[model samples]
Target: MSELCRLWHVTVTVAGEEVEPLIVRNALRRLSDQRPFLHSLKYAGGRAEIQYWEEAESLLDASSLALRVWNEHRESAGLPRWEVVGLEVLERTVFLSRGMEYHVIVDLHDVTPLPF
Candidate 1:
């Protein structure tokens, strides 16, 4: 039988040696270009948070991919060599149930790197 796929909302936080704010912003922009499916991107000199949705067969699969995102795109996006400091993965139903106050609706057309 084929495994069922589920939608997961993932938030990954990474941190590393400090760099200039502009550099971090530019790097995040590049990441957005490469990963347009990302819902939002926010960054500071030494840290960043990436939010997106992942379709996977299991939570573990989703978490594994989320953990690899930073390292996988580091060179292409010119991202800092950061380590994953936090990770949150919630099922779609659970995420939406958290209510509007906890959600940030992001329009791709209006997307710009946000500072955290």
Candidate 2:
């Protein structure tokens, strides 16, 4: 089975009004439908503000999808300026947890044991 990881953060500002997180989330969800890799969204800082994004895959896919969605909506709606200011990768490591750090994102459907 193959595993995927995605994480990112973006900031969008309204020209003259406060933005809403729900709006951003909905927009992101719509983008996810088209991209299929975006997993979820998170909120921080304050209301009508986005602190970060937890994507299901990688920054490349997440950002690309988000940028496209934002641009499309921006051109049509003409409300807020959607901007992605930051993108980052979240890596895993074996540490004091004493367990495998990686996880399965999709079922492998394999029953054969690996030969060491």
TM-score of each: 0.88, 0.35
lDDT of each model, Cα atoms only?
0.84, 0.38
Which TM-score value belongs to model 2? 0.35
lDDT of 2 by residue, 1-116 (tens): 13665344433322224456555445544444443433233332222222224454665665565445445655443324645444433322322143422322222221111122
Q: Residue 47's C-alpha lDDT in candidate 2?
A: 21
Model 2 residue runs over 4 Å out of place are 1-17, 44-80, 90-116
Q: Whose lDDT is greatest here?
A: 1
Q: Which ten residues in a row have the lowest lDDT in candidate 1?
A: 107-116
Q: List all candidate RMSDs to the true structure.
A: 2.6, 12.8
Considering summed lDDT, which 10 consecutive residues are worst modelled in model 2? Answer: 105-114
